[model samples]
Target: MSPDLRVIVYPPDAQGGRRVRVDGEILGRALGPNDLFEFLRQAAQDADDVCLDDGLLIEWRGGGPALGSPDAA
Candidate 1:
């Protein structure tokens, strides 16, 4: 990913789905890594080049890659 590229994974909603944004444009909701990968793949066509664990490339809010409601029992 380019140094100028910015990907933000917003906090999960009540259903445990997160909104994905690339460079400020909202792509869609992702329920897991595959969902997020597809979004990035379509947006940049270089999903293989991205690393979910790379903090500099992706900004994960509320939680990391784990999928679940923060308040879920």
Candidate 2:
């Protein structure tokens, strides 16, 4: 994952799937980190080299990883 790439994981939807966007382009919906990784991989990103915890790489909106609901407090 390039440091310049802006990755955003949106809030979880009713089915607990989150929308993933890379560089302003919506890749797809991810249900977990593995799904997100696959999406990144398909986007030509170094998924294995990318750290999901790195805020510089991923900007988790509404909730962070481990959050499974949009209503999560």
Judging by TM-score against the true structure, name the best candidate.
2
Q: Tell me which residue pairs clash in candidate 2.
A: none
Residue 7 lDDT (model 1): 92
Off by over 4 Å in 1: 69-73
The C-alpha lDDT values of all candidates are: 0.82, 0.84
lDDT of 2 by residue, 1-73 (tens): 6777889999889899999998889999988888888889987898779887778889999878779734332
Q: Give the Å error, residue 59, model 2.
A: 0.3
Candidate 2 yields a Cα-based lDDT of 0.84
What is the clash count for each candidate, in the order shown?
Answer: 0, 0
**Candidate 1 lDDT by residue in tens digits, 1-73:** 7788789999989889999999889999888888888998878658778888789999999977774533322
C-alpha RMSD values across all candidates: 4.0, 3.8
Off by over 4 Å in 2: 69-73
